[model samples]
Target: MKEKKEKWYKRLEMPDAFVIIFSIVLLAAVLSYLIPAGTFVREEVDGVTRVIPGSYTYVESNPANVLDLFVSIQKGMIDTANIIFLILIVGGIVKIIEYTGAIDAGINVLIQKTKGRYMVLITLVALTFGILASMGLVANAVIAFVPIGIALARNLKLDAIIGVSMIYLGYYAGMVAGIFDPVVLVFAQTIAELPLFSGMTLRVFIFIGMILSVIIFTNRYAKKVKNDPSKSILGNRPFNDDEGITNIEPPKFTVLHGINLLIFVGYLGFFIWGAFTRSWGINELVGVFLMMGFTVGFVSRISPNKFVKIFIEGARGITYGALVVGLARAVVIILENSQILDTIVNATLVPLQAMPTYIGGLMLFVFNLLFNFLVTSGTGQAAIVMPLMVPITDVIGITRQTGVLAFILGDGITNIVAPTSGVLMAVLAVGGVKWTDWLKFVWPILLSWIVIGTLALLYALVTGYGPY
Candidate 1:
C-alpha cells in the first residue's frame, strides 16, 4: 500500500496543554528581558493590598534567568497546591460516585424521560451550571459535574463537546454576569469600592443575554449533530473508553441509585449554602466532598478496600488535569517574577486612558479579554486589574461599578477558549476533549459571547452603572 500525505492543516498541529503553557512561560521570560520592569506603590485598602494610581514607576529590569524559569514552576505548584489537591480529591469523589453506577443510572433515566430532546437537557443543565456559578460556585468545582454532563450527552447520542459545553458554557455565562460571584464580582466590586451586588439589575440582564446565547448556540450545534452524527467536532475520533463515561452501559435505576442521587443533589444544595452562609473555602469544600463520596460509597455497598482502589483510580485519571492547573499558574509566576506584569498592565491601560469613558470601558473589556490568558484566576485578575481600574474609571468618567462590569465581562467569556485557564483545561481533560477540538467547537459561541459581552459593557457605560 502506498503512504498517503498528511494535509498541511493536519500537519500544523497545536501542541498539548503542557507544551502550550510552557511556551508561554518561556515567552514571558523573554519579554522580561525586553520590557522594562516597573512597579506601583501598593498599600492596604479595606483589608486588602491595592495598587495606588499615580504610583507606578519604572523599576530596575529584573529579567528572569533560566533558573528562575524552572524555579517558578515549582513555586507555581506550591502556590496552587490547594486548588490542585481540591481537583484531585473531587476527581476521586466523582470516581467513587461513578463506581456506584448511580450516575449512569440517573443519566439513563434522564435520557429516557427527555425522549432525547437534547436541547432541553442542554438548556437545563447549562442553566443550572450557570445559575450555581453565579451564586459562587468556584470555577474549578465545575469539574465535579463534567462526568455527569458528558455521560448524559453521550447516553443521549450527543457528542462530548455538547456535554462539556453544557457545563462550562453555562458556567462562564453566569460567571461573566457576576451577579453574586464572590471571586469575580465581589473582589472586583470591593476593590472598585462599589456597593456589593448593588448593580445587579444590569447584571441580571447580562446573565439572561449570555445564558440565552449559550443555549441557542449549544442547541444549534446539538440539533445538527443529533440530525447528523458526522457534524460532531469529535467525528471519527474515539473517546477514551477508560473515562467510563464515554461508553455508557445503561444501568437500571435502582432504589440505591435514587438514594445516592438524592444525596448528591443534597450535597450540592449544602455546598451552595456553605458557600453563601459559612463562607466555606476550598479546604472546607474538599471536606464536604469527601463526606459525600464516602456516604455514596457506603450507600452503594462498596467495600472499604474497593473504595480505596476506586478513589485512587479516579485521582490517577485526573492527574493530568490537576497538574495542568499548576502548570498554567507557572506562566503568571514567571510574569510576576520578571516584574513585567505591571508593565504589561500599564502599557495596556495607557492606550485606554486616552479614550472616552464608553470607549475606554469597551477597551477595558478587550484588554481583560487578552490579559486573561496571562492571569486566568478570576480573583487574581481582579486583584491586579480592579485596583488599577478604580483610579482609571474615576478619571475616565465611568463609575467604578461600570469598571467592575467590564472587568468581569472580559475575564470570564473566554474561559472556554483560554489554554492558560487551569479550571478550563481540567474541565476539558475530564470531558476527554482536546484543546484544539474544543477551540474549533467553541469559537462560534465565543464570538456570540463577545458580541453579547460587548453590548453589556456598553450598556453599563451608557447607564453609568453604579452606586458610587
Candidate 2:
C-alpha cells in the first residue's frame, strides 16, 4: 500500500514541461488583468503629501490591450531571435574547437593529472567557469565546458547532471552576488543613482562567499547523485533509453589541439585582464569572445560550410532559451505598466516600516523571495523594485544598501526553483533531467540556502555593511 501510494504521488507530481510553462504564462496574463494597475497622482501641499481622490486613473493607453499584448509578445520573439543569433555565433566557434579535439584533449590531460581527485578537480573547474560566467561570457563558457563536463561525468561515473548543475548554479550564484555583474551593475547603479562599481568591496566579498557556498552545496548534492541512482528525489521513474542515444566519433587529438589551446588560453588571459582592469565594457568583452570564436574556429580547420552549419545549429538550439528571456521581459513590462507593482511594493513596505530594523530587513528579504517568481531577472527586478524599495527604506529608516542586499538575496535564491528561469530549463535539457526531477532534487537545498542567504542579508543590514 505504501509503495503504491508513493508511485501515485510521483506520477501525479511529474510536471509536463509544456503544461507547466503554459500555466505560468497564463497566470502572468491573469495577474496582469486582475491586478488593479494604473497611474496614481499624489498632491503635495506645504510639504505634506496626500493621495487625491480619483487621482488614480487607469489610463486606457496603458491597460493590457490587444496591441500592447501583441507588441510585448513580438518583443519577446525578437529578444529570443537576438539570443539565438548570439548563441549560434558563439556555439559554432566552440563546436569547431571541439571538432578539432582541443577541448577533449585538454580535459583528458586534466583528468589524468587530477587522478583520484577528479571530482574535486571538476568542482574547481566548475567554480572557476562559474565566476567567469558572471563576468558576462556565459554563452562562450557554457558552450566550451558542457561537452567537457559530459566527458568528465562519463569518466567519473558521476551523473552528468552534476556537471551541468555545477556550471549553471555556479554562474547563477555569482550572478546573485552581483559583484561587478554588468547586468546588476548597470541596473542597480542607474536606479540607485550610485556610481558604477560604487560598492565594489562588499559586493566582491558577497560574490566570493556565494560562489563558495554554491561550490560546496553543488558538490555535495552531485556526489549524492553519483553514489546513489535509486534515490528518487522527484520520483523520476527511469525512462527507456532506446530513442535518445546518439553515436558520434570522438575527435582525434592532433596539432590543431595545440593551436586551439593557445587560442583559448590567449582569449581567457585577455578576458581576465579586461575584467580586473575594467579595461572594457560588457559589449567589448562580447566582442572579444566573438574574436576568440573566429580564431579558434579557423585554427580547428573547420571548413567554411561546416562552420556555418555549426553556427546555425548552435543558434537554433537557443531559440527556446531566448523566447523564455523575452517572456520574462514581457512580464517585467506588464509589471511596469500596471502600476500594481508600486502598490505591491508600497503595501509590503508600509507594514515593515513600523518594525525594528532587523525585522524590517527580514520582511524585505521575505518579500524578495515571494516576488522573485514573478520577476525572474535579478537586474530587471531591481530596476522595478529598487526605486520603490529605496524610498520605502528611507521611510522605514533602513539603508538603501540593505534594500539592495535583500533584493540580491531574494533574486538570486529563487532562480533555483523558478519555473521562468531559462538557465534552469537549459541545464535540465542539457543534463537530460526532467523538470520535476530537478525540482525534487534541488528544492530542499535551495530553500535551505534561501534561509541562510536571508540570514546573511539580515546580518549585513544590522551591521550596516552598505553605505547608510
Candidate 3:
C-alpha cells in the first residue's frame, strides 16, 4: 500500500516548475515578515518588569521609501562581494586538484578495492571526508568528491542521486556537527561568551554519533534503491553504458601523483594539528588551503598560466552559491536593522515562559529551525538569538549551555534543506539533481533526524549537562 501510494504520487504531473520555485520563494518572504520578533524583559528589585528593546526598529512611517531599499540592496551587494572573494580563493585550490586528476586518482583506487559493496563504499567515503571538509575548505571536499560519487553510482547500477545525497549528507552533517568548524564554533562561543573549546568533549560525541547515523541511514537507503529500482529517488532509468567506468587509458600514477598526494596529506595534517593543539585559527586554515592549491598545481606540472585559468573556472562555478549566501544575509540584515528580531522572539516565547524549563528549550529548538531559513550562517544566527535567549533561559530556569545546545541543533539541521544554503545548492548542482527532486527524497530523512535530535536535546536538559 505504501509503495503504491508513493508510485501514484510520483505519477501525478507536477505543475509548471517555475510555479513551485516561485511559491517556495514567496513563502519564505511571507514568513520573514509574519514571524514575530523575539524579546525578553528584565526585572528589578522593585518588582517591576521592563520590556527589552530589540536591535532594530521597524519603520512604519516610511515603509515604502526607495532610499532605505537602496541602502539595504547596497549592503547586500557588499556582503556578496566578500563571500565571492572567499569562494574564489577556496575554489581555485580545489579546481587545481581536480584539473590534475589527483582527487579522481585517489577515488579510483578506493572504488577498485571496494568492488561489489558500492553502498558501503559511498557511505564510508562521505563520512570520512565530510568531517574534513568542515574546517573552512568547503568547496574542495564537495567538488572533489561529488563527481566521484556520481561516477561510482553509475558503475553500481545505482541512481546517481543516492551517491550525491550521501556525499552531501556527509558534508552538511559535518558542517553542522563540527566541533572545530571555524564559523560555528567561533559564533557559538563568542555569543555565549564561553571559553573556546569548553564544550569539546560533548560536541565530539555528538559529531561522531551524527556521522555514524548518517552512514548507517545512507547505506540502508542506498541498498533499498539498489534492490528495488522503482524505489530509486532519481528514478530507475537504465545506467548509461557509454559513460565508461574507468578512463579508457587510466592516467599513469607518476611521481607527480605522489607529489600531489603528499601535498594533500600535508595540507590536511597541518589543520588537524592546529585544531587539536588550538595553536591556530580560521585565518591560518584559509592560508594553508591557498598555499596548498598553488603547491599542488605546480607539482602536478600545471603551468602557472593554465592554473590561473582553472582557478577562474572553479571560481565561476561558485558565483551562484555566493549570491544566494549574500541575499540570505540581506534578509537577516533587514530583520536586524528593523529591530523586528526581538519582537518575533518576545511574542513567541513570552507565552512559553510559564512552561517548564525543558519546554522552553524545546520552544527554542523549534524557533531556531524556522529562523535558520533566513539566517543560514550558524555563527550569525547565534549572535542574534543567544543574547535574547540567555536571559529568558535564566528566568525559565534553563541552563545557558542547554540554550546553546538548542541553538546548535536548530542551526545544524536546517542547513541540509534550507533553500538559502549555498552548500546545499552546490551539492545538488554537482550531482545533476534538481532542487525539488532532492527535497522530495530527503524530506522524510530530515524529519526523522530532527525528531531524534530533539529527543537528544531533551535528554541533555533532563540530565543537567550544562549550567541551567
Candidate 4:
C-alpha cells in the first residue's frame, strides 16, 4: 500500500537554533550590500556610549562578506564569553545541588502540600519569578531556574515546555512590563530624560497583566498535558528524561537536604542583593556561584572527587545551551559591522514620524518589536534607539514617557519570540526544548502580550501617558 504524502507546508520544518540564527546572520550580511549604511553621532558619556538625537547620516555601505560572517562569529563568541561561562558554571552548580537530592526533596515537600492544587503552585512560582525579574533579574540569571523548572515539570507530570513557560514566560513578561527592570527601565527612562521609573502606575498594571497572562496560559497548557500525556509538545515523554523525577519516588526531605536548600535560597538572596546594591556582573556572580557550589557540596557530604565529577557532568549537559549564546550574538555583530542597523532604525522612524499621534504611538511599539530582532541587548538598544525616540514622541504630540513605554514593551515582549534573543534560545536549550516546539506552544501567549502591549501603548498616546 502507498502512503499519502504530507502537504508542502506540513513538510517544511524549522531548523534548529544554530541554523536559524546563522541564516539570519547571513541575511544581515547580504542586506549590507543592498541597503545603504548610516550612523548616528555617538559620544562617550560617563564611560558609556550615547547616540546623539538627529545625528543620523548616510555613510558608505560596508557590506559584510563571507569572511566577515566567520569573523563576526568569533567576535561574537569572545564578546559573550562572560555570559557563556556563567551558564556553564551555573549548570555545574545546579547539578551539584541536584545530585545531593536537595532539589528533589525540597520540591517533594512542596509537591505534597500543593498536590491537587498545582495551579496555585504555578501561580506562586510565576509571580515570584516575574516579581524578581521586574526587580532586575538578568537574562542569564534566569538560566539558574531552568533546571529547577524542568524538575518541577517532571514532578507535575507536565511537559518540559510547560515547566519552562512557568519560569521563562514569567521572567520575560515581567521584563516587558518594565515596572522596575533596572537595566531596561532605568536606562531607557534616563536616556529619555523622564523621572526614573516614573509613570509606574501604568507599568504596574502592565506587570500584573503580563504575570497573570503567564499564569493563566501556563495553567491551561499544564491541564491539557496532565489530562492527556499524549498531547505533550515534547511527545509522550520529554527530550531528556533520563533522571525522570516522576518515575522515581522522591527522597524524603532530610536535614542535609534542608541545609542544602537553605544555603541555596540564601545564596540567591545574597546574589540578588549584591546584583542590585553592589552592581554585580557576570564574573562576580560566577565567583559567588562557585562558592555556593563548594559549600553545598561540602555540606551535602559529597567527596571532592565525586563533586568534581558531578560538576563536570552538569556542565557538559549544558554545553549545548552555553555555546548557542555566541551564535545568537553573531547576528548583532554582523548588523553593527555592516552599519545598516542605524539606517534601518532611521528608515523605520521616518514613516512613524508622519503617522498620527495614536498611530505613531502604536507604531513605535511595532518598530521596537521588529528592531529587537536585530539588537537584543536592552541597554544597548536604548543607547541606540531611545535617543531618537524622545524627539519623535515630542513631534508626535505624545509624552516621552509614552515613547519609553513603547520602547520597553516592544523590546521586552518580543524577547519571547525573537530569533535574535540569545537568552531566550539559551533558556530553551537548557530546558531540553526544541526551538520549534517552544514556538508552537508560545505563539498564543506572545499574541496576548502583543495585544496587551499595543493597547497599553495606544492608551498612553491618547492619555499623554506621562508625568513629564
Q: What is the C-alpha lDDT profile of model 2 across 1-468, one tens digit per residue?
A: 999999988887455655576556555556667776655466554453434433345554344665665576566556444443444444455556656677766666666678847558656876776677556555323533454565555445455456556666667666666666766555655556566656556666666666676667667765675566455242232221113222233355567777788887788678656755675533454576678878876666667788778766655544444444455455556566655665555556557767877777788888988888766666556645666666667777766777777877787788877766655654444344556666766765586567667767766776776652
Off by over 4 Å in 3: 1-77, 85-95, 129-168, 171-209, 224-250, 268-294, 303-322, 337-339, 426-434
Candidate 1 structure lDDT: 0.81
Report residue 43 deviation for candidate 4 (angstroms): 1.4
Q: After superposition, which runs of candidate 2 have C-alpha atoms over 4 Å from their true positions? A: 1-13, 40-74, 129-151, 179-209, 228-252, 265-294, 308-323, 326-330, 333-339, 422-437, 464-468
lDDT of each: 0.81, 0.61, 0.63, 0.83
Highest lDDT: which candidate?
A: 4
Please, what are the lDDT tens digits per residue for candidate 3 over residues 1-468? 999999999999755323453344444345545654433453332342333334344344222133444465457657655444555556567667767866656655666778767767876777766676555444333533565566566556576667676677777667666666665665665556666545555666666766776777777777887787678665644222233233244455566766787797787677657755765544565577788988887677778899889888767665544444445445555655554556666566556567788888799889988878767766566656766777777778876677777888788788878766655655554455555667777776688668756877787778776631
Q: Evaluated with TM-score, which candidate comes out highest?
A: 4
Question: What is the TM-score ranking, best to worst?
Answer: 4, 1, 2, 3
In angstroms, how far off is 11's CA in candidate 3? 13
TM-scores of the models, in the order given: 0.91, 0.75, 0.71, 0.94
For candidate 2, what is the lDDT? Answer: 0.61
Clashes of each: 0, 1, 18, 0
Candidate 2 vs candidate 3: which has greater lDDT? 3
Clashing pairs in 1: none
Better of 1 and 4 by TM-score: 4
Residue 306 lDDT in candidate 2 = 85
